[model samples]
Every structure is written in structure tokens, then in C-alpha cells.
Target: MNPGRPATGGSTTTAVLGALAGAVLLVMVLVVAFPDWFAPYPPERTDLRAVLEGPSAAHPLGTDQLGRDVLSRLVDGARLSVLIAAAATAVGVLGGALIGLLSAAAGTRVDSLLMRAVDVLLAFPELLLALLVVAVLGSGAVNTALAIGIAAIPNYARLVRGQALVVLRSDYVEAARMLGVAPARYLVRHVLPNVSGPVVVLASIGTGTALITASGLSLFGLGPRPPQADWGAMVADGKDFLQLAWWVSVTPGAAIVLVVVVMTLVGRGLQMRVLR
Candidate 1:
């Protein structure tokens, strides 16, 4: 009958998920940062004798069609995915925040103009927009990241702009304005700091999305070309051998799903905590 008693089922489930997600992410970071430490063989190195072999003591995850170790490639692909996703997300966040803040600060005329442009961009889904960009820019890791980042800009810009508008109207902001605070100082000191929380949460969630998008592009041959490892490219590579070597593609696909789920869970948790 104690009101302070912790809820059992939901709390337990959440705690378990949090722990699992954290563990997976830690392993991912470690593998990405120092792949040689975790991988028994170089990702690209091949052993013709082990070609398309099933899991065993020597190669727990087995070998790919090229006789390359699946486990090692997965780790390498993860590093590539994470690096591209992080870079793209940084671009999206930085550019989006700047545009959004500018729109919020520049009065109704500028706001309307900027928002209309955003609306035009938002007419297309992020994936479609990114594909369009990739088509024009040609395919590679850096180009894919840039395309994804550009596609992501509208979402962040709109979200930040809305929040910034609200913050700009608050009594504190009005008071600062009346006290002759310069526009730059007022925005830097007040507007951005206030609106950054939601932007951060969105950025965290969007990184996973960007990763998935990048993978999708790689699958379509618009991302990092082989024999460079990439999750999507790995899946694409194994597609022809799906029946014979399920682990080749399936493992990387599972990794992608797991990472996205973890990021979503963590981002949701952060959102709830920050909003509260």
C-alpha cells in the first residue's frame, strides 16, 4: 500500500531494455573504435578454404562468399555506418539549428519565406530527397552522408523554428528585448539555449534514421562501393547467396535493426526525462 513503491512490470521491462541497449551500444562503439581488438581477422582478408562456410569455433559468425570473416566485416561495416551517420547528423543538426534560429529571429517576413522553402523541401520524404541528391552528386560515403544530412534539414529546422518561436515570445525574451539587449546576444543567451533540448532529442533519434537511410542507399548502389564494408552493401552482396549463406546478409541486417531500436529507445527515454 506504499505509494512510493516502484511499478514492477513496465519498469522492469524498461530497465532490461535500457541495459541491453546500453550494452549493445558500448560493444558497437568499442568495435568501431578498435575493430582489430574484437575481430580475429582483418575484415577484408579472405581465406579461400573457408568460403561461404557456416559458423564454427574459428569463425563464430562464419565466412562470406568471398571467404572474408562475417564477424569482422560486420564490425567494420558498423564502424562505417556509425561514422557516416554521426557526421550526417552533425551536419543536419548544425545547419538545421542555424536556419531555424535565423527564421525565428528574422521577423514574420523572413520567417514566412524560410518556412515556405522548407515546406517545398518537406514535400518529399527524406529518403526520396536523399536519393535525388545522390543521383546528382554520385555515390560514396561522404556524398551519401551529405545527401542524408541535406534531406534531414527540414525536419530539424521546422522543429527548432517552432520551439524558437515559442521561446522568443516568452516574458523573459520580451523583457530582455525591452532592456536593449542586442539581437545576437539575446538569441545566443536565451533563444537557442531554451530550444536546444528538443533539437538534441530529435538529433539523437535522427542519427539512427540517417544510418538506416545511408544503408538503404548502399543497397541501391548509391553509397560506399565494395569491397569496402557497409551494412547495406553487405546485405546487397549477400542477396544473391541468401539461400546458401543466410548469415552473410542477415547478420548485418539484424545489427542495423538492433542499433536503430536502441537509438529510438534511448532517444525516447531522453525525451521523456528532458520534457519532464
Candidate 2:
């Protein structure tokens, strides 16, 4: 057995999940990087005669109520979804990590105060919190990103703080403190690196959550305005035509589900690897 490989029993399962996730990730990346090249028709172009058509040679995935190519929209939707998720996760990870580091380093009234504030924020359900933020900030891609990012911060902050506290007790951390290392240097050089693995895993998982949240917001008419080709907006537009053009809503919904499921599996795999 290869020393680096997992045991045979669970390895097959992991491999299958990993393969599925890798395929989804590849499709998502390709769509975002070259949407026009992959799309069969312009996402915004409409053909009234083609509206509600089922899958065919001309339109593999069929056409929506607006006669826009379903496949093209789906592909472009991947780009939007992935971009929003990545941006929100990046914001959450950086903001949360900084807040966590500060909370741990302060170690007194400041720590208590910050954690209490986080607790207050965490008291609301994530979706509710996101809704509140979006309502306050008004809807758009930027606001959606910010709302999702803020909603995710408490989770990352708590995880980072726990990890940082444990790292602070380690021998190396003690040595650094005894050597009179500046608090900033100690956190940057020691605490942050040691606590980063779990944070990374959490951020990956949070990306899936962010994507789902953004989609939900869009579907509810609180995201980017129409004609922008967002997956949620696509689903919303297809709702009225469900009897005739189910593919519009169904396809985008499936895309969202597939992306989130794959991301979750990948995140779990990373966590398992980290634990090992």
C-alpha cells in the first residue's frame, strides 16, 4: 500500500466523490473563463418560435419561455454563481480571520466584547441575517456578496478563535511570547499559519453556502436585475412556464444543487485529509 494513500475500505468512496467534485469544478471553471466559447447561443438572444421547445439537435437543453437557449443560460449561470460564491467566501475568510485573530490576541474585555457581538449576530438564522443585510444594503451583486460574506463571518470567526486559542497554548507560541515577540508578529508568524487549515476547509464549505444563498436571494427578486443571466433569476423567470418549459427552472436548480453538493463533498474530503 502506498504510504500516502488512504486505506482501501473508504478510499473507493472518497475517490468516487472526488472524481464527481473534480468534474463539477472543471465545468464551473471552464464556464466562468470562457462562457461565450462554451455556450451554443448568446444567453440573451431570444427566438420566439423556439420558445418552450424540448431538447433537440438545434438546442440540446431546449429553450426557455423567453426562447433563450437553456444550455447557454445554464453555462453562463455557472459563471455567475461561482464568482459570487468565491468573492463572498474570500471576504468572509479574510474578515473573520482578522476578527478572530484580534479576539484571541486581545485576551480580555476586548475579546469578550467582540465575541458577544458575534454571538448577537449569530443568534439570527443565517438566511434571515442575509435577508436583513440585503434589505439594508439594497439588492445587487455587490450587496449580495457583502450580505453573504457578513452572514458567514460568525461561523469562520468562531472556528478561527477556537483554533487560535489552542495554538496559543502550544510550546512554540509560548516560546515566542517568552522571547517578547510583538503581538502582531506572533499572530502573523505563528497563530495564523497554525490555524489556517481548518479555516481553509471552512471557507470552502462556506462557498457552497454563499452560492445557495445568493441564488435564493436572486430567485426572490432581490439579486441582480433581470437579463443578467443569474441562475436564480433564470429559475424565477421559468416559474410561470413550468407546465411547458420546465427545463428552465429545473436545469438551473439542478445546476445549483450539483455545484453545492460537489463543493460540500470536496470540503469534507479536505477536512478528512486535514484530520489525518
Candidate 3:
């Protein structure tokens, strides 16, 4: 019944979401910065005495079929997952943004041709495209990251092109052109900056998707090989023992969910702040 209560409620929700996102980020950082400290046992080490054990003081999240520590593997997996996501997102954003700029600057014929190409890429399902690339390139962390980056480029290209076109028509760009600014200078100094805001937000959101995709590829035996401890790979390895040791699968799965959820929340907040 309070007249001003809606604003209060919205602020509270944002604050809570922000806290959740911060905690997730901190956990990821810890996993990367102090992996050995967080993981009591080596991720690849097998402990025959504790094979397939449930959660216990000696192994907080239990042991896997190979008797490797579940918690250790999950912690190590975070580092690999985040690394691949960041690398793929960077490649997509940089390559796509540049292509989008070129297409926009070159006018109707170029724009149409580039957009059509984007459409072709977009026509295929993202996962399918990634799988195709992995199949061709062969599976490994680097190849998986490259494939995800390539799969994501068309989306960023389209987004940046649309934004660049809008900016191209703006008064600043026209004034720069009239003042005889070089095309490269105009784009770098004026057009690119304005369009980059949305590109950045999109890139942040894309990170979570990239991580999920890379992990999925790895799970399917098309990503990093054994002992690397990627989250998807962990889940894939534990599937056969699901009934015997749920912790092996559940721990890594939960970690993936938690990280992706927090990233999504952060991306939404950034979009609201920047794109609004």
C-alpha cells in the first residue's frame, strides 16, 4: 500500500543480485589465484582407499570413480572454464566489431553482403556450428575456444553493425566527415566508441554462453582431454557412476550453474545501466 515502496523493492532486488554476483566472482578468482590451497588433493590424483566415497571430512565433496577429489576437480575446473570463456569472448568481440565497422563504413552493397553472410552463419544452430568446427579442427582447449569464438562472431558483428549504422548517421560523424577526417580516424575516434557500449554488454553475456558451449564440447569428447578438469568433462566422466557417487557430477554441475547464473545477473545489470 506504500506509495514509494516499488522503488524500495527494486533497489533491494538489485542489491541482492549484486551481492550474489560479487560472491560468484570472488569464488572464481580464488579458484584461479589459489587453486592448490582450495583443492586439498590433486585433481588428477587417484586415491584407491577412498574410491567412490560420499562427502566426508577427508573429502568434503566426496571422491569420484577414479577416487580423485570432487571438490578439487570442481575448483580446478573453474579456472579452465573461465579462461576459455574469456578468450572466446575477446576473439568474438574484437573480430566482430572490426568487421561490423568495415561493413557499415562501406555502405549498402558491402553492408548487404556482410549481413547476408552473417545470416548464413546464424541460420545454423550455435551448438551445431561449434560441433562442426570441433570435428574439423580436432578437440583441445584451444580449438574448442576458437570454435566457440567463431560461432559467436556473427552475433556480435550484427549487433555492432546495427549500432554503427545508427552512429554513422549521427551529427558527430557527419561533422567529422565534413572536417575531412580519415575514415579510419572517424571510426576509431567517433563511431567505434559509441557503438562499443552495447557490444561490451553483449560480450559479457556471451562469456557465460561460451563457457557452457566449450564445456559441452569437452563433455562430448571434443574439447580438452582427461586430467585437465573442465566442468563439463567432470560431469561427463561422472555420468556412469551417477547412482554410486552423485557428488562427482553434482558438484561440478552446481559450480557451472552458479557461475553462469551470476554472470547472467551481472550482464543484465550492466545492460540496464548502459543500454537504458
Candidate 4:
């Protein structure tokens, strides 16, 4: 290959993954935004006569134990997955940013106190922290979101704090300080905007993490109640029937894996682009 020519293999792989991720995310968004448009039957509608039936023309993904259309339930489940992920990501990002900014802006005593608390929280694995919170709040979609969001906060808080410290030490910050700029105005206008890029990247990655945590919680019976179509719950529902009907559990599990992998790839791509 000519020295001037860009390597084809690595870039080609990244491009392919990006395209795949984008296509998956687009489908997910379409399903979540308009589930009724994609679903052939009401997700809750049951046909007991057809229970555990294999895939056929009428039901492309087959039927669950209750004879509910697996395809329709999967489409409906997309709504819950996307909603919880979005909500939890927003909560984690916004709350973490505020805490991080506060830690950086405050005096040494306050900064020390806040960072120590964050460190303590970070000591635990994200799932364990989420499970602890869910145990206290009780199981439900809202609680699941809150639990995952709270678990996610420490990561963002530490990330933002590090960025904030760097921005605070920059020459423009020094210049602003010299010019007698008010502390509040200086931090808000100069500090935050500069540090926000990294925070955005972190939030993008954290969204996938939040989704996984939420789904795991649901699988463990800590999310929305039964009969509601949830991907995690669907997988749980089919666990015992895996030997007889694999599609019921496998389809939803595959969806979760696809979503998480795509999100991570996209987030990594965005991070690389941002860094460049």
C-alpha cells in the first residue's frame, strides 16, 4: 500500500459497526415512538389455542406461553426500554453535572466532602448499588429508573469533576479571575461550557449502562408488573420454557444485547470524534 493511502481495514470495520448501530438505533426509535405502527396485534392480546406455537405467517416471532404475539410484545417492550434508559441517563447526567460543578467551584472543605462521598459510592459496583436502592424503593419501572440513575451518578460526577478542574486551571479562567469577573458568572459561562463536551460523551456511554442495569433489575422482578411487555421480563418469562420454545426468551435477550452493543460502539465512535 502507498504511504499516502489510509489503511482500509480498521476504518472499514468502524464504518460497518457505525452503520449497523445506527440502523439498530433507528429501528428501536421507530418502534418505541410508534409501537402500534409496527405491531400486528395488541401486545396483551392472548390466543391460548396457539400457545407455544412456532413461528408462522400470522406470528413471525411465534407466540409466548400465554399465546401472546412475541413480535408485538417485543415492539411494545422497546418503549419501556428506551424510556427507562432515556430517563435514567438524563437524571444521572444532570444530577452528576451539578454535583461535579459544585465540587469544583466550592472551597476545599466542601470539595473534599463531596468528592469523598462520590468515592464511597463508586466503591460499589453499579449493579449492586442499583439493587440496594431498588430494595429500599420497591420494584417498578419508575423505581428501576431512579435506582439505575442514582447508581450512574458517581461515574459522571468523577468525570465532570476532573474536567472541571482542568478547565478551571486554563489561562482564560485565570484571565477571568484577573478581570474581577464574578465567581458565579465565571464558572457558569466559562467553566461549564468547556467541560460539557466530555460530560456529553460520558452521558452517551452511560445511557447504555443504565439500560443494562434497568433490564437486569426487571429480569430480577424489580420492574414494571406482569402482563406489561418488557424485554427483560419477557426473557424471564421464557426461562423455564427455553427447552421447549427458545424464541420467546432468546429474541428479547438478543434485542438487549444488540442495543447495548450498538450503543457502546456509537458512544466510542463519538468519543473518538470528539477527542480528535
Candidate with the greatest lDDT versus the true structure? 1
- Across residues 1-276, which tens digit of lDDT does each residue of candidate 1 receive? 677987688867877887887888888889889988888888989889889999999999989988999999998888899999999999899889999999999988999999999999999999999999999999988999999999999999999899998999899999999999998998999998998899888988998999999999998989987778999999998999989989999999999998899888878777877878
Q: Estimate each model's TM-score.
A: 0.95, 0.95, 0.96, 0.95
Summing lDDT over every window of 10 consecutive residues in candidate 1, give the lowest-scoring window: 6-15
**Which prediction has the highest TM-score against the true structure?**
3
lDDT of 1: 0.91
Write down the lDDT of every candidate, Cα atoms only: 0.91, 0.88, 0.88, 0.89
Cα error, candidate 2, residue 91 (Å)? 1.1
Off by over 4 Å in 1: 1-8
Per-prediction count of colliding residue pairs? 0, 0, 0, 0
Worst 10 residues of 4 by lDDT: 199-208
For lDDT, candidate 2 versus 4, the one ahead is 4
lDDT per residue as tens, model 4, 37-155: 99999999999999999999999999999999999999999999878988999889888888898999897999999999999999999999999999999988888888899998988
Return the TM-score for candidate 2, rounded to 2 decimals. Answer: 0.95
RMSD (Å) per prediction:
1.7, 2.7, 1.3, 1.4
